[model samples]
Target chain A: MRVYHFSEQPYHGAWEADAPSLRVTLPNKHCDPKVAADLINWRLDEWQLCDELGLNIACNEHHSSATCLSASVNMPIAMMAGRTQRARIMASGYAIAQRPDPIRLAEEIAYIDVATRGRLDVGFVKGAPYEISPTNANPVKITERFWDANDLILKALTHQDGPFSWESEWYHFRQVNIWPRPYQQPRPSVFVTGGSPGTAKSSGANGHGFINILSGWNARTLFDMHRLASLEAGHGVTPWSKFVYTALMGVGETREEGHRRLMDIAGYFRTTSKVGEAFMNPPGYMDVAGNVRWLKANQTRGRAGNHFQAAKRDGEKLAIGSGVGTGLGVSAQDMADAAIAFCGTPDDVYEQMTEFISHAGGVGNFVIMAQGGEMPHHEACANLELFSKEVLPRLEEFDQSQIHADTEERVLSQRDEG
Target chain B: MQTATMTVDHVGIDVVRAGSGRPLVFLHSVGGVDRDGAFLQGLADRGSLTAPWHPGFGHSELPGEYRSVGDLALFYLDFLEQEGFEEVVLVGVSFGAWLAAEIAVRDAHRLAKLVMISPVGIKVGDRETRDIEDVFAMSQDELTEAAYAEPERRKRDYSTMSDEDLTALARSRESYAFFGWQPYMHNPTLRRWLHRIKQPVLVIGGTDDGLLRSGYLEGFVESLPNARLSRIANAGHYPEVEQPQAVLDLIDSFLEEE
Candidate 1:
């Protein structure tokens, strides 16, 4: 499996003049396009560094709050065009349906693809309720918008000369001729965010990739659902390459250290619940009615609010959380040990990652969460260095042979069965 | 009546007292309010008004140590208790509204009636939430266009302002660091604690607010036990500026009711 390092630059420091940090905090709203640009540059620099270190792709997300400065994924895609040639620029997603003109999105993607020389992995999303409000698009229609926009973007980017007319409940367009076609012939590889059965089905039917933000354990079920969807959609046992991608944070000197780091990140989210919620859950963005309806409908499912929350809880309980705190839950070493979970001696992390990868069905691309919460720059750089030295080389070697064999076997078996 | 320009915790907070009645405290929003700022004027025109600069806004000495919204809330609570305002009405607008909600949750008995206008704490679904990061990216013209309804009113040249006035605005934005440094302009659990507010709350939101939608007001009303909602038409996020009379009327109606 190809390991792609994902760095989310969460700019952390005191908001006041007295606060000290490498980056200066400009006096502006978090959602301003300029701040988004600055953050994109910072993250791209990190990504470029990772590419130099032999990582596959650099990743970031679009969100309104503190967790992410890039509210619109398009900005990063545009910015990363000239930065790096080798590493794929992954816009984890832009809430495609949220924009008024999907055609404009098509044009932008085409422009970026041409500029980047075919190194773009586009992630389409329906967007969380919080991020959706800024677009002024109806929340309920977001799913429909995503599908329509995806179809249009794909058609516009791939098809050469013909009037492309689309008639849908939400969108209506005729004679769509997108200028400056993408560098990749069939358009850049498409990846959809979310782990729902519906998303899996859409990914499979469309012959795109599926990215699951869930924990490793729940990821199995997601992959299973994707496969089932592919089978149902007549794809018939497709290779894992076109199926599943998992995003996670890794750090370790030993197995224990890796677990501790994951826990610390989780703990940061847990203790700073208000901060996370404030950053993640902006007002008038998500479908409050839908969320309330879903909660009421699935109240029997216990405390799980939605799929995202469910995955987080499951991931935290199984690996993410357990890695941070020890059995007793209250100990200085335990808290201190948490840092080691995400930041440790390199060899130990490789082992922890290998075990996670194996359990996670040997994921195609392991998107490493390089930045989160208030993790310092030096710490992030240190983690990256250790990961490169200790873990990446081993993974690269294993992937070269393991992935090739797995693909060959799977393909041969499918052909024989057919 | 006594007026003192004392520094509390190195924060030059102004204290205003009038009449032998119940103590009412007011926390102004971003820009410093003069006698014309209806909310401050209305309260002072009615009863005792203890209007403080909130460390970074008005004539107050900006505290070097303050950071994070919780710190501001805690400081205000301490400010009230220190000033011997046993029972008080806490009125906050915009950022101050969030502070008011937080204060009520933290210590409800100290507050009599909590008033928040265009308060932002909970995530309101389907409204255009202003991206603080994005706002910072704009030029002064763009900032004014985004922030105020009357863009013409914003001074073309801030350079012309007196050193003190300029410093105050800068300091206010800097103090904004305490409340809005990280995660932009929100405290996640503040919404969770809305239910904890025992005191009556009057939430006023602009009907035409592009930033925050009407549903936010409804959510606020639903969340708080003794909360009422009032919508101001033709008003943006800052209704106190856009529809001052309507806001004052709502406050009057809310306070007059049993």
Candidate 2:
């Protein structure tokens, strides 16, 4: 398994501000440019460390939000490609649906592919719900828009003959041609992030890799759905390597030290859930049936309410559907139990990761969020150095064939249930 | 009021009608007007009244091609032409009023008069100013307080509602967001064509509509050639529901004017 080092490059200095939300509505006046510069540089240094450690690097984008300072996914990828020599860079990824100009995005991707010397792994996401207001994007049928944008982007990347006109329900281009087509022949491997079975199945059917972030047990069903859909679409058996799972990880000399260090990084989950309820689920972000289910759960079982509040309450395990490592009161034990965070000494973290991969029926690429929230730069570097020295090398020795029988059985059982 | 499905332009629309005479078509707001509700009943008692759920609002079929309020206006015009209605008195509430204005501007030969209650269709303020509150950006409690004169009367307890009721409400909210999310609630250029709606219009505003800016109704009336502004007491965005009898009496008087 290949491990990718990741960070949200958060502006945690604003985490203490008296704002109703950390996203969208939160004014940027609270953000200090000098602090942001330092945070950006710190994360870049961490990505460079990954290069020396023989680990891959990943970055994601968000807008009008203090949670993630990387507003443009391409800028970081471009910078890292120039700065790091060996790390395979991935964007987890650009919100293709929210971006109005798919051609420009395609051009940038091509530029990055060439710059990275064919090391770019492109990922397309349907955007977060809070982004609806910032982007002024219509939430209804946004998934359809995502697929349409994906089609345009891929066509723009590979169509090298000449200028071409393209028109779709959401996008229109009079003359479409990207210069210096991708360095990778045809295209780089495409990945998509999704939490729903429908989205997973569609991703598989489209023959793209699937990435699930902190979804916990529900990720199994999502992965299974992707595998089954791929098989049904006549894509043959998809290797376990096509699936990726992202989680937070911290390593220290002692168990207590690791747990304490990780609790600081877990601030990402706490502050993210601090968003105003208005922006949490915009109308039409989910379909009528999905909204109804959410409403029912929210009203009756109190399941769909804010994780921030739930974590504040003493001793309530975060309701299902929550990404692991979420909420303010989540402990190190809770995170390890949920498989959202693997923290401890090198041996402990390695054991936890191996067990998680085995239980997941095998995840080929494990994206580790090494730094987030208020984690100090030195602490982050130390954590990475320890992980690289012990756990990462051992993890490389794991072979997927060992779990092939169990994964096949699980897939068949899931298919039979379906 | 009688409820039925009307298939227009190869799509189904949930329609409610009552009484009989010169057709008085009533277009509903975001939450949808009930067939047995006091507003429709009051309109029905006055004349033949027809209120149809805007596409995607309730049980209506929303054609994928339909994106904006303009598409809805066009569909309504086709429906009126197909139904062969004449001298129709068109009335609309909130979002529906936006559609009514669009339709009148496009073609008002079939429409004898127009009534717009808490209408939101035109840009009444400068670029930096917002004439209508961003309902999508407000919490449920905030929206409720903005939408009602007496917020408690309109506050909903979802636990008590049936699945079917919640589903319909969810669908209406989704449709509302789809139509009014971008460029907000007003069509930027609708103000330019208000003069094209030659039919006399009665622009109604509620005394307590927190959703609209102070002079929004007056500004809407000023853009028209023959339109007047009126206000219903103790009401908010949905004056037709909050003070149905007063709104009905105002419409009754306006329609009777020679």
Candidate 3:
């Protein structure tokens, strides 16, 4: 599997337990500028290391939050685009709905593609619920804006001349034109995260790649849908490997150490993750049906709300079980067991990941998140080194080609039978 | 309030009607309408009141092609024409005021008088500094604080709220965003078109509206050729909901003009 290294680039400093949300309500006192500077530099160094190691660099973006320090995902990508050669720059952000100007977005992506000489994978999302309001983007019209922006951006990139005037509900541009043409024909490859069937269909219809970060079994279902969509869009026998799978990964000297390290970080995240009802799902963020499904899926009904209640701004951290793991009712070990957390010795991680890839129907791109929450920088680096050296080369032979060939044969036979 | 269902432009919608006499249409704000408020009855007591839920809010059907605030104005204009109401008085609150102005600017021959309560369609200054309060950015408690002039009026026991009430509120905000999210609660070009309105306009606002501020309301009034401003004391965003008798008193003067 082609592995891409990713991190949320979490700020591990003091966080207020009583705050309504890390995104909107949390006071900025928790963010020390000096600490942020160090983290940004460290993250860049790590990404540069990934490039040297012949691994893909996946950069992420989030706004108005200390949960992730990378507010602008493109800055790092643009900076690295000129520097890095072999590694692909995955700008999995510039959130479609939240961005006010899609024309500027198209021009920016094209600039990046030129900088990277075409090694760019554009990642778009409707953005997390918290992101909607901070940008003052309405959740009700997010879908409309997303589709409109994507269509407009594509038009701007594909066509050479545009003083193209188009009117839509969300955007109106009298003269739509962008400079710094993309390195790739038409544009760089487009990838979108799929948490819902709607996104899967959009990805399929647009003939774009689908990435499932932690959907587990649902990833396979989405991949099948993507394949069907690709076919309907007249791109036949589309490689299922284009659908990438990501997991929270860590390697330890022993199994116990592995689980403990992951659990410690999981628990550290619990305080910031105690999202308020309104912040988590704002009014009108989703339609009636979507809201119901979201509420059900994220039922904090049994949450011991006061579990992490601490009098100080730096609240007393709770144990793993009584912490963030409780939000999903899954322990660190449960994550390992489910392949959501690939933590163990190098050999153990390799075995678990092979099983993960096999279970995912053998996706080509296996994205590994080595750093998250409060994991120590040195330990995370060590884990990555071990993973690349000991585990990376071993999985090259594990093949999904047989399954793909068989599926292709089945589809052809079905057509013949018809 | 009595709810009525009808089809306008082949779209189903639920319109709330109250009072009897002249066919005066009362358009609601972002919250749609207040149930336990006396404003509807007060309006009904003076004249026949008809308030159609804007397309996509409450039980109203949202047309697939429905895009801009202009569409809502056309939807109501067609509704008024289809219903055959002649010489109708237009009254609007907050977001509804913007829609009323949009319709009145397009065609004001059938419109007799216009009343805008804390209207929010004119940009008083650069949007960064003088834009309307972003209720979406506020936490629930923060939203409550910024919305009301009275302490008691600001509080609602959400724990005891019914599912229907909660759902309706959510739906209201969604539809509110439908027309208002882009231009961000005001039309940048709306101020230029105010002179086109042929009706005598009454611009009423609460002195303590923490959102748009009273000066912005006056700015809307100043734009119209035949508009006058009136301020209500000890009230907030929904002065009509807070103290209906005072708002009705203000409406009486404008309705009496013709």
Candidate 4:
């Protein structure tokens, strides 16, 4: 099984005047940038530690936010390209539409792809309004701009003629040819981030892939849509290979440790301001706006007379109470019973992931949010080590036989039902 | 109160007067009110003050077609001449600073002194300028962090605020865009016209300003023939709020010298 670890540099410490160190308020500790950088370097080192560990690691883009330091995704991608010779570099997605000139994005992506020798997975996105709006560009036009830019970029990358000519309402280009064609034939594997069916359909039709970040009931709905879209597109239906990626936050040496990690991350979300909530939770997608409206509509139905209570009944199930309970050292099964929560030791995480695979038919790829929400650097490193050593082995075994068999069985069942 | 009558695009221009002594006109910033005339009141407390809200701002009725900062300045100049307030002291902040500078450039004889705080007009290549995109992307805390020296104090508890209050805040902030839009902070011609403005000018800068760095203030002061720079430490883009006493002291000393 191919495993990709996602690292989000959670700003977990207080600003130090004397040194570049963050004094974390909770779990009460000092996390220096040096320590954080070491943790990152070690994570990269582990790739060489195992033959099964693919060179592919993921980083993201953000700006002037406390949570992450990689405001420019290119910085990390460039670093990874320079360091690794074999593994693929996947920027989970960059906010390409934010730039006025798409050519800059095309040039950078092509450069990285060429340097990496074809091992590149480019994930495209419109990005959050918090990032897009500040650039004087309308957030409402993000989807349109992304598609237009992508079309131009793809044409520019693959075309060999003296130049390319294209005209769109938003963008017009004459003689657009990007130099140093990618090492990968045609281009790098393109993926789009979305949590809804419409996004899945578009990705499938465009010959691109979909990386889903939804969980619980929504995951089931999204996966089903992706499968149908693949089938309808006449791209032979295979439950395991169809473009689908699932993300989960993992931690723990024991099942208890895993539960605690999940809780710790969840607590981070609860207290943080919803200031950039527009970025994390965009409207219209997953009926987010409708959920907000529903909560407002049913304010009287709440027991505690708070927005949270109203939200529980109307909005997508937020993992607040379960996260708190799990962090407090609650039993895994007990925490699981509280809600459709995902947390536990490496083994527990593997089992839960497998269950999700079964529910969605069969899993093809797993992307773990290995670092998130004020998770300390050392703790993140330890979690990665535990996961690599303990969980990956079991997952690799499942990939060998059970996962394939499960996929076959699921297809057969569907055929029989039809 | 002395009032002036000047017609621009068939609309009446009212210049209200308060206090009495040295003639000084108060130019309201992008979102400020002319009726309340806080700047004029403050100026009037010291001496004579004339306040007028630019067209399309506050209660001012928009003329048939008002365009460009220059048109607004011309209209203000006519009002000043009609009111017989020659060689008057002009005070402006933000976008108002742009209009005041524009007016001074057109006729330096009309303005004896000028004070521009966190002004917007000239573009300096060395400094990283904040565009509309940068402003909108900032969180309330981020915006306040960039705009004020003591951001923690200005950070409001919106949780307890009523929806009406939230709506009002949003509306007020949006209205600020009316004056600051178009070519954004730079007018291209503003820098070239700076040397033409012979009036004694004081440029106030906030050291901690994230939008425009202190280096920008130096460039601004250097552009003007008769200009001096005064900085407020531990202050952001809006030093008037963060270091009000410092701003007051600097203004007082500068005015006394003039």
CAPRI tier for the interface of model 4: incorrect
Candidate 3: fraction of native contacts reproduced: 0.27
Local error of candidate 3 at A159, Å?
A: 4.5
Candidate 4 structure quality by residue, lDDT tens digits, A1-418 = 5666765555545322232111111222344677667655654454333223442577677554444556677877787777777666677777767777777778788889888888678887766434543355544335667788888888777787767778885577786778788778788878877665677766666766667753444555565566555655666444464444645455587777886666555433332222332233222221323333433433211111111210111343343322112233334343343323456777677777677666666666666666566566567666677777777778766752465466555544564566
lDDT per model vs. reference: 0.60, 0.84, 0.73, 0.61
The TM-score values for the models, in the order shown, are: 0.52, 0.95, 0.84, 0.55
* lDDT at residue A332 of model 3 (Cα atoms): 62
**CA lDDT of A326 in candidate 1?**
21
Q: What are the C-alpha RMSDs, in order, of all predicted structures?
A: 19.7, 2.8, 5.7, 10.5
Evaluated with lDDT, which candidate comes out highest? 2
- Better lDDT candidate (1, 3): 3
Residue pairs with clashing backbones, model 3 = B19-B44, B20-B48, B21-B48
Best by DockQ: 2
Q: Could you give the DockQ of candidate 2?
A: 0.60
B134 Cα displacement, candidate 4 (Å): 8.5
lDDT of 3 by residue, A338-390 (tens): 55567778788888877766555557787777777777767667767777787
lDDT of 3 by residue, B162-245 (tens): 556555555666788767876788888989999999679998888778888546877877789998989899888888988789
lDDT of 1 by residue, A169-267 (tens): 667898888889888887888888776667766776776778776434566556655655566567764455654454445466665655555543443
